[model samples]
Each structure stands twice: as structure tokens, then as C-alpha cells.
Target: MQKYSTILLVGVVVILAATLAGVLVFMKNNPAQERALLPLVEIAPMEPDSAKWGVNFPSQWNSLQKTETNNIDTAYAGSSAFSWLERDPRQVILFAGYPFSKDYNDDRGHMNALEDVRATKRLNLNDEDPKRTPATCYSCKSSNNPGLWEEMGMAEYDAMSFNEMTPNINNAIGCSNCHEAGTMRLIVTNPALNEALEAQGKDWTTFTRQEMRTVVCANCHVEYYFDGPGKYLTFPWTNGTRVDQIISYYEEEGFSDWTYPEAGTPMLKAQHPEYEFFTAGSTHYNAGVSCADCHMPYVRDGAAKYSSHDVHSPLINPEQACGQCHTDVNYVVGRVATIQEQVAVTKIAAEDALIDAINAIQLAAANPNADAALLDQARALHRKAQFMWDFLSAENSTGFHNPEYALKICAEATNLARQAQMLAAQSVNDPSLLTTGTYYTTP
Candidate 1:
């Protein structure tokens, strides 16, 4: 009877242990379902002061403060201050008709948007000038944009100049820029982007969180141009996001920013499309990475976790930004450095070739008996070549994104420009006695 009782006790203990194990496994696998009953964190928009926003989201705000540090560098664009105009003067000619040609600088952090715009000489707005610049300019530079647009309507917002609306649009790029006021949920405030997406049969409402992470930045970092007299903001992606597709759209619509005096070609200026170029690269394409993946890495502070919003180069903090996924800091650094070097070399070569082509076209244009057909051929070549150059060069960090793709674009651009020049010369009746005309264009 004692032996039977002992056996019964052992069996009971085993059953209890088995039941406990099963419960643990169930909880592990169904964590989401268990968490579904928990209360949600309430997040609301604070005053325009970034400090107040920081109180609610300390991690995001603290990370954002890092943008003040301008020492980091990556394969391409970073937090460092760069004189974009001095880097390549050929841009002056390429953007001869646009405000960018006058003065353009590399984008720093969102924190600098308001001050940078005010300090940059390109706008030419005087303190006393009551006529403010177009409200369209503020679209990408602030979170208050949506609030203002919603309150005043698009027409009223566009009608007001910078000086006129300075007091009202005080908030620079911040939480409100990409999120709803009370919920902090991602929202699309840009009408132009929404329209473009709809035109392509895409529903912006259904964009996944991964897409939104990048699209939020795409709100500002994209290729855009002002349309009509109201200077309504526009993105050229109505047809598609490729170079040729955008060019075709521009051609079909007869859009021309300004006519170049030297080359005598109507030119279309290409804005910074960082997100667009990133989307085309392997990091984004294959790895399913977003701008936030590199720019805004996650950080843990004690028990709290939040995304770092110091949007800059991942190269600065490879261990946190990329090494977490890649596992080898040295390998990631080497890859980025090699890509940057290759892009720089390719860019220099392409620029040299472009300069030569531009000079040749200018010479052809100056000729008194320049055959109309020959001149047209030269102009077409210059246009195509310029577009290619712009596409490759506009990407601040080229090879880092995709070395092979970047090099190919540069090589193709160089060839196109050279061929265009050669074809122009051949079209002329006299090939041997081509005399150089005045070279007044500054590069």
C-alpha cells in the first residue's frame, strides 16, 4: 500500500509540471492576443516647441537633437555642411534658369529647414519685403503645414508669401509634419503626392507601416516642381519613377523651367530625390529597408524603447544602424567607403564629358549659318545628356546605394553626351573647319 501511494504521488507531480509547460508555450506563441487586452498609450500633439514634444517622446526627441552634430559622413550625403555649388560648378549651367543654380546647399537635418531656408540666399526675400515667398516652399519644411493648409485652404496658403505668413507658420519640421495630432499615426498631408498615387491607381490609405516609414521622408525628399501661376507643388511621378518616364511626362506636358542662353535649350530642373534613389537601390529593394532603417535607428533607454530621429548617415553609427542586421561593422564600412570612392570617380569623369558637350553645343548655337537641323540635333543630344548627368549626380550618395547601377548611369551619361556632340558636328555641312565660338558659359 505504501509503494502504490508513492507511485501515485510521482504521477501527480509529473502531470502538474506538464500542464505548466503547456501554459508557458501558449503564452509565448500568443503574446499578441494576450497583449490585445492591454490599454493603448495615449499620444497627443504638444505646442510648437520641440521640447514639449520631447517630454512625451523623449527617445525620438533626444535622437533628433543629434542632428545638431555635423561631423558624420557616409558614402554620400550626411549631416556635414557641404557647399553644393562649389562642389560642381557645372551645375550652375545645368540649372542656369532655376533658383537652385543661384545657390543650393546639401540638406542637413529637419531642424535646420526653417533656418536654412531663411539663411540661404537663393530665395532673395528681404526682411521688409511684405510679399512672402510661395507657401508651397513650406510643404516639406514643417509639420504646421497641414494645419495651415487645412485652416486656410490650398489657394490661401499658396497665395501668401513667406514674409506674410512667417508668424503663422513658425513650426519647422516636427512630429506634426508626418503624424496625426492626437494619435501620432502616419498621415499623408501632401495633396500632390496623394494625387500622383491615385493617378497610378494606388490607395495611399492602404500603405503599410514599412512603406510609411520611408514615405514620411519622401514627403520632402523627392523630385518636385511648381505648376501653374499659383506655384502649386507637384511631383513628376505621375507616369512613373524612372528617369525616362519622368522625362517623357515633362516632354508630353511641354514643361520648361527656363531657356539656357548658351545652349539655347529649354531645361527642366531636377530636385533632390533621395528617397526615390534609395528605393531604386539594393539596400531598399532587396533588404526591405526604409529611410528610417538607416536614418532613424531604434534605441533603448533603460526600460523604454523608441526610434532615433536624428536623420543622417547610417555610417556614423554603423553598430546601431546597420551592424545589428549585417553583423560585421568593418565589412559594412568598407562597402560604403568603396562605393563612395567609385561614385566620386565616375561623377568626375561624367562631369568632364558633360562640360565638353555643353561647350560644343554652345559653339554650334553661336554659328551664323548653323543648319537648323544640325542645331536641333545638337540641342536634343545636349538635353538628353544633361538629363542623364542630372539623374546620376543629383543622387548625393551614388555608389553607396548601388555601385554597379551608379557607375552604369554615369558611363551611359558620358557616352550620350559625347555621342550627342559628335552627331551635332557630323550634321554640320563643314566638319573639318569647325571654329570655336565665344565660350562665355561659366562652369
Candidate 2:
């Protein structure tokens, strides 16, 4: 009993000494008059400079700068700017007749968003014609975008071409985009997300505090399509968040992004829909895992605990990101790798099937004696197959988010594309073309 009491007394004394030392250091560093003389900053509207915010919240701003690092790597994903086409030539044939065929890179850190977008071949650099892309392209690239949109109303902003808006969108995403000035409370800056929620009878105020962290990111990260008339950014979740449900909604609205130049069939390009997949009854979502919970896990900085501002793949810090729920880190990572491998195999198989279908359709379309009804059926199948394949392709998770659904989608895509190939073979009167699993070289 005496030894225990002595140890407790020593621990209390150590803590008290540390606290006294901290107080003396603070007092010496910041004299009372100097502390009182500090001015209260009045934040102005549309402030895009993150350095200005750094003056008051140095921790967050400094931490956020770490996103500039693109050195980290994982088994399937990393921070490096990798060319998708150079690694997988099959993507070129699959996305033929689309801007993606021109160039698609593996996504990098958010810090590189503006730089990468400016360098991408997807955007036309011709100064004479500034309308290659739309002002909507700046939606996710800059913090100044909200200010630009506010200065020019939605209609005028949406109407302006990409070049017209480029001069104003000078800042990369920063504090102002996701937080209220002075107070620093989280808030949604993107209007399209607000409208999307309202259309579905939901609003931000109705959500819990834990849910808001995820909600803010859902603003720009989800799949979106520009409304054809005004070129306004729109999220297609009115029908539902599932893959097929979104397809149905697009069909109902008669929305087709572009017609394939190879087969003349309308194609819908799926954007990165991470938010939708995460929320669609995933085990983590069911267990109340917020997007920020995994992606922005908390870390200790001296005596302070703050949500990490270095938002990148959670795989980079699985101990803090996944270890809270998962006990075995190796097992979980190995499982994720396994799932990714399976998804990759299935993805390739689906791509091979779709390539064959595209070739068959092109050949059948050229044959004057081909049956028109059979050609139409094959085109419809091509649409379905491409939609299913692209959904998995465009998703950032690869299959880790929902492995079962990912595999199912890929399997169905392969089946549909094979069926289309069979019909195309019949139309072209070539039985040899019906061979399955045979890889065909793209012309």
C-alpha cells in the first residue's frame, strides 16, 4: 500500500511540474499586452487564398499542404500520376470514340487537381476556341469556383465556356471551399449537391454531425452529368444510387453522353461514383462508418488531436484508418489485395468481351445484307454491357468497397457483351466469330 501511494504521488508531481513549465513558457512567449493587441480578422467573401486562412489556423493549413506529396504507393493505388492507357491498352479500345480514349490517368492527390487538369489532353488548349470543355469542369478543381459562381449567377456561369472561367479559377481547393469563415464550422459550398439532396426530399440540416463530414466531400466527388441545355452540373440520383437505378433514370430522361463512333450506339460514361457505392448498403455504412472516418482519421499532434488534413488513400495509413475496426492489419490488407486481383481478372474478361462485341457490331454494320432487327438488338446489348463495365471501371475503390457487387456487375457485363457478340456473328454470317475467351486485336 505504501509503495503504490508513493508511485501515485510521483506521477501527480510530474504532471504538475509539466503543467507549470508549459504555463511559464506560454507567458514568456506571449506577454499579456501582446496577446491582447492581436487583431480580430474580418474574413471577406470569396476569399480563395488558403494562406490567409493559415494565419489563424496554422495546424490545418500546414497539414493540408502535405497532400502535395505523391510518393506513397500501394498494391493497386498510389499517389503517383500513372497513365491508364500506357498500362492497359485495352482501355483505349473500350473507351474509343470518347474523350477518355484520348487520355486517362490514375488519379493523384487532391493537391494536384488543378495542375493535372490543366495538363490533361482531355481539354483543348486552343486559345481561339475556348469552349472545348465547360465551366462545369472547374467545379471540383478550385476553391475560387464558388466565388466565381456567386459573382456570375449559375445560368451565366454555366453558359460561359471553359476559357472564359479559367482566369478567375486561380486557387486550388482550400479551407474556404468546405468551412465557414471565422467560425470554421463545416458547410457545403457546392450548389449542385444541395439541389441534388433537395430533389430527393433530403437536406443537410436533417443529418447528424457525424454525417456532415462525408456530406461535404460528396459535393464534388460523386458521379455527375452536365445538363444538356445549360451545361449545368447535375447528379443523377433522383431514381436511386444503385448502378441499375441510375441507368434507368438516364434512360427515362433520354440522356446519352455520346454515340460510339465505331458502332453508332449511344454510350453513357460513368464518372467516379465513390460516394454512391459507399452509401449503397456497404457493411461499413451499415456499421455507421462515415467517409471521413476512414479517409480522414484522427491523429495526435503533440497535445492536440485533429482530423488529418492529408486526404489520400486510407491504405497509406491502415493502422489508424482501418485498425480501429479491424484487428488483423495484414489479413485485412491481404483480403483487399485479393479482392482487387479478382476484380482485375473479371474486368479484363469483360473488356475482352466488349472489344469483340464492338468489332462484331462494326463488321455487321458494314455488311449490307445484315438484318436490321438483329443489329438493333446487338446495339442494345452493347449499351447494357458498356454501362455495367464502365461502372466498375470508373469507380475509385476498384472492388474494395463492395466486392460482391463489383464482381456481379463485371460478370453480367461479360455475359451481355458475349450475347451481343453472338448476335453480331449471326448478322455477319460468321460462326467463327462466336468463339468465347478469344482475345481480338483492335484495329
Q: Give the TM-score of candidate 2.
A: 0.87
Model 1 regions more than 4 Å off: 1-49, 73-76, 126-133, 281-283, 430-443
Q: Number of the top candidate by TM-score? A: 2
What lDDT score belongs to each candidate, Candidate 1 first? 0.70, 0.81
How far does residue 416 in candidate 1 sit from its true spot (Å)? 2.1
Q: How close is candidate 1 to the true structure, as a TM-score?
A: 0.83
Compute each candidate's TM-score over C-alphas: 0.83, 0.87
What is candidate 2's lDDT per residue for 1-443, written digit by digit as tens? Answer: 99999999999999999999998898666534233324256666667888887776556777788887756867667888788898788888888888899999888877777888888888865646634677788889888877877787766787777787788788888887888775566777888888888889998977887888878888787888988767888899898888888888888888887887858788889888888877777777778888888888877676555678888888889998898789998899888889998998888888999988888888888888988889888988999899889888888878888788889899999999999998988977888767654555433
Q: List the residue pairs that clash in candidate 2.
A: none
Give the CA lDDT, 0 to 100, for residue 204 in model 2: 90
Tens digit per residue, CA lDDT, model 1, 193-302: 78777888888779888888888777777888777767778888888876677888888877877776777877766777676667765555567787787777766676
